[model samples]
Target: MMWRKVKKFFSALGPGLVTGASDDDPSGIATYSQAGAKYGLATLWTVIITFPLMAAIQEMCARIGLVTSVGLTTTLKKHYPRPVLYLMILFSVPAIILNIGADIASMGAVANLLFPSVAPIWFSLVFTALLLIVIIFLPYAKFVNVLKYLCLVLLLYIIVPFLTRPDWSEVLHHLFLPRITADREQIGMLVAILGTTISPYLFFWQTNMVAEDVKVIRKQVMVNKRMIIVAGNEADPRAREKRVMGLLLQKMGLDVNLGMLLSNVIMFFIILTAGTALFPKGVRNIETVEQAAQALRPVAGDLSYLLFAAGVIGTGALAIPVLGGCLSYIVSEALGWKGDLDKKFDRAKGFYGVIIVALLLGLLINYLGISPVQALLYTALLYGVTSPVIIAIILHLANNKKIMGEHTNSRWSNFLGGITLILMTLSAVLLVYFQFFNRS
Candidate 1:
């Protein structure tokens, strides 16, 4: 019975796990590491606060997909004004491609740390090409499962934090109690962490994946009902009702809320790991994931270093595909092209073409001699600025009765989402203030 339950649980896990794991991409790792190294637990409070906000936003995205059977872009294109949809995608696609470039660079940096002789540029190009091939050719189900397993590498962060033997009382105090030092560098790092944690790609990916899952569910349900009808007597209404209810329960058992909670818990541990391992050592400067991994060496030993490196590489692999695929989804939706991973490449020519172009462009960006660290920072700032518009559209779509039907966001969801929108608004304000005003 226990084994059966475990199998069932594994079978049900998909969109939530993938979205959560993608949150810890190499750039995100750098942001979290910088937060810990710069202010220790001072910025740790944001992690706890952002958990529910992440869930609320993602849940709305999921709800939009499940109810509308359309991706966010597609829905926006149909329901919202064209100008609004175009404006959102205009900011979103380039930002996503830039992020892919950063992840590629970060992955190469990790590989270079391990090998020391491999050139970062060569490794980045090779990695990007390999990722594009895998995502473009591989079956969608297989690609998703591969990403789920890659998430296991994140456990290294969990283990590394414990090995550091951080002061528990101090960790708790800093986490629950906020601190502000009035330092610009510290404030900048805080904003970066917030931007990284609550990203826009996750929003697009989560909604589209949810739509994909619903498509699968709907197909399975139709097939199952046909099978049951054939197996039962034609006049047996009771048997038909029983079969339908069983299917409903099976679908509901996925417990999406619970999955979101588990994902947020993993995120909390990541922030905790960085807070404990790098924060107290006065290592204030970090521009790369490799640096964060190396910082774990003396404090958490060789195993920790290996673990951090593995996490970076694995998460990078998981995220690069989603980043590429998201751009594909947005463009396809904008241009009125059919887009679904379940559909064959030949059937969705424009969709697959967009994915290929985005991936290739991302790969080319690495060879352009741009510093990946600066690219990552710029990506964060870009997403920070663009997130408010996306959030506004999402809230408006999710609340529209014509789109979500009965699955429109609940009162509580709207309340939380409104609050999240406000928080993002403030973060964007601070980001602009620092970027332009404070720079002088």
Candidate 2:
């Protein structure tokens, strides 16, 4: 029975798990590594503090998808003015492309470290082409399964912490304590962590992915002659629909909570590994993933260094597609064009077009001579600047009864999401302050 339950849970895992894995992409890895190496485990509190905040916001996005039967942009089109939604699409597409650019470059850099003979540029082109092919040709459901398996790559980070032999007492104290400095650099790092953690790309991705997941579920229900009916409220058709949605939401809660928990666990361990290995020595300045990996050598051994580098490639491979997909979904929805991954390329030309064009543009960013670390930091800062508008819109949608129907966010959901909104708002505020007013 236990085995069957486990199998069922794995089978139910979809967008949430993929999103969680993508959260730890090379950009996040870079930010967290910088945090650990520069500030030690002091930023460890973010791993815990952001879990509920991230999970809550994502859960709201998922519910919006499942309840509304559309992607986030589509829903926004209904409630907000056309120009507002368009501005969102405009801001997000470029930002997501930049994000994908950074991830691809990181992947290539890692490839170079692994295969010293090959040029990183060649690897970058090859990997970019492979991602395009897989996402373009594979059926959506199969692609999702491919990502789920790819997430296993995250296990690499989990093990590296063990090699460091960290002091459990200090680790525990740091985990629970909220230690922060008002120094501009520390504030900037915190904003980057928050931006990378609760990202705008994820807002669109989760909403759309959950919508697709529900469509698949309803199709299965139809095959079973159930008409997607509810168990409890069969008398009223709309109410029965609401009940059925409740069931979907319940399952989604499990998947999302597990995914977010897993994402944060990986985050915590990665920071811990870097902190234990790098901070005690005098090595604090790590600008790139490769640099951070090398910094681990004196304490964690050469094998750990190689594994750390490989992880950059793995997580980047997982993340680039998500960034690309979020762009496609936003543009496809904005254009009122058919766009579902399960649909054939011929059927979803606009959708596939957005993905292809976005990926190609992202590929172009590599040759522009921007270092991967610079790209990563630029991506974080952009997200930090834009995340507040997205979060406020999300909070608005979660509370709106007309859109979510009977599935409006509960008080607890509102509380957590409210916290997320305040946090992101504060980040934006500090970003403006440090960038402009504090230029001294």
Candidate 3:
């Protein structure tokens, strides 16, 4: 009975779980590892703080997808001005492609670490090809199922910290008591962590995933997707539909909360591992996933080293799809092109074409001589600059009765969403100032 319940619970978890796991990609691993090496456990508080904010924002996106039966990009195109939509695409697409590049580079570099004979670029080529084939051939449901299982690979991080036996008391202290400094490095790192955790690409991806999932569910409910909710009928049919939607929203909330919690927990442990293993040894500057893994060999042993290196490859595979998919969804939706991962390549050429182009471009970043670290930094700057606007738009969309109708944001949702908006805006400002204007 217990096993059955557990299985049922996991079965219900879909896009939210995948989204959360993908957030902790190779680039994010480098950010957390850098935080640990540079600031010790001082940054651990960020994981705790970001959980609610992340969940709230993602939930709003999910809700928008569910109510409208369309992706956020399409909704924006319909209701908002053209320039606003273009600005979103302009800031988001390049950054996402750069992120995909950094992840591909990191995956290749880490693969080379495990096997010295194979050159990193060769590994990058092989992995990029493998991802494209898998993404293109697999049906949407099957591909998502594969991604759900891939999320378990993050368990590697949860185990690495335990191998080193960190001090429980110190970990607890940093986890609760927020510790930050005013210096540029610390501020910039803080912003990077926040920017990475709550990204703009994720907003587009989550909304699209929910939209696709709803289409799938509606098909399952009956022959016609329109049966799930009747907009004009305010009597029994609409009321019954609202109840069904309420249950779905409840489940979605659980999935998003659990997924965000898992993401943050893995994040906490990655920082902890670096803090315990690298910080005390004066190995502070970790710019790449390879450096983080290599740094752990002596202090955290071969097992820890192996796990860290392997986790990078797993996360890269998991995350690059999301990165590519987000960009594809944005472009596909904006252009009124048919896009669904489950759809055959012949059916959705523009959709899959965008994904293929993004992957190929990402795979070329290493050959272009741009370091994974540099790609991530540029990605962070762009994400920081653009996320506030996206978040603001989501808040507006979620609360707008015209779009959402009766399924608008509750006061609690609005309160949390408001906080997320303000915090993200402030972080973006700080990130820009530190990266460019603030020399000191």
Candidate 4:
């Protein structure tokens, strides 16, 4: 019975893991690596600080999806004023596509590291096409499983960090003590790391994945609901008890809050590993995933380099689909089209088309001679600026009684979420000020 229960729990896990792993995208890796190499453990506290907040936000997104049976875009359309929804979608859609474009370039960069003979542009195009084919043609279960395994690539960071033989005392001290630098560049990088880690794409993806989880649970509970509806006719107490158990299981499955916490914890560690290993050595400059990975080889040895490279390839591949898919979700949801991965292409033509188009456009962008490193920097800055708005919206949506019903955020959740919002807003402001004002 215990084994069976564990099996059931494992079976239920999906969206949370996917969203968490996706957080380690190439851009995120670059940001975190830069953070570690430059600041060392001084900024390590941010990872710990962000864990709960990231989890809370993601959980709220999942909850919104489970309760409403709608995607984030659909909920925004219904609850928020039209103009607000339109503005949010407008900012969100292109940003996601551009990020996907950056990911394609990043992934191609990884492939080039492995096979230097291949042109990066062609490599990016071929990889984009392959991603499209897999996502469009493969079954959802298979696709998710592949992504899950891809997450193992992140373990490379763990091994590499350990091999670096970081000073444990300093690592601990930095993890606990908050260090502030007046240097504008450092502050900007800090904000960039925060922005990329707790991003908008994860929000949309988490919510939709929750909705999908609900559909699965609903199918499993429909019979129980029917039994309860017909309870009076049978008048069987035992049957009613069984119905209640089914309902309970369904309720557990729909717990979006729990999902959010789980994903956030994972995010915290990924940042933590990077902060401890990369930041303290004065290895500040990083522009590409390859640079980040290559930096590890010197300290962590060839094995570490291999692992870092593998992690980049794995995370980059996993994120490429999501980066495109999330944009597709927003476009389809905004336009009021049937949008779901479970649906066949015929049923959701526009949805799939958007995914394909985003992937192709990303491919083209990579081929246009735009350096992946430059694209990542721009993407990070863009996300940093736009993140506060999305976070504010998420907080409002989560707290809204009309949307969340009885599952509205607890006072603690709201308070924490508020704090995160403020911090993110401040970071965005600092980043812009540094970029445009301080440097001047």
Top-scoring candidate (TM-score): 3
TM-score of each: 0.90, 0.95, 0.96, 0.87
Off by over 4 Å in 4: 1-10, 223-282
Candidate 3 TM-score over all chains jointly: 0.96
Off by over 4 Å in 1: 1-7, 226-263
Higher-TM-score candidate of 2 and 3: 3
In angstroms, give how far residue 367 of model 4 lies from its true place. 2.3
| Backbone clashes under 3 angstroms, per model | 0, 0, 1, 7
Give the number of the best model, judged by lDDT.
Answer: 3
For model 4, name the residue pairs that clash.
36-278, 36-279, 37-278, 37-279, 40-279, 40-280, 59-260
TM-score winner between 2 and 4, please give it: 2
Task: Rate residue 367 of model 1 by lDDT.
Answer: 74
Cα lDDT for residue 262, candidate 1: 51
Sort order, TM-score high to low: 3, 2, 1, 4
- Better by lDDT, candidate 2 or 1: 2
Output the better candidate (3/4) by TM-score: 3
Predict model 4's lDDT versus the native. Answer: 0.73
| lDDT for position 268 in model 4 | 47
Per-residue alpha-carbon lDDT of candidate 1 for residues 1-440, written as tens digits (9 for 90 to 100) = 98787556656786877787788888888777777776666776776787778778887887777777788888887777899887787778888888888888888889888888988778887887788677767787887777776766776667777777878898789878998777888777777777887899888888898789777766875877653653355467666745554443335334445545555555556666667777676666777788888887877688878878888888899888888888888888888888667777788878888878887777777778767787886787779888988888899888888775555777987998998899888889999889889885
Candidate 4 weakest lDDT stretch, 10 residues: 255-264
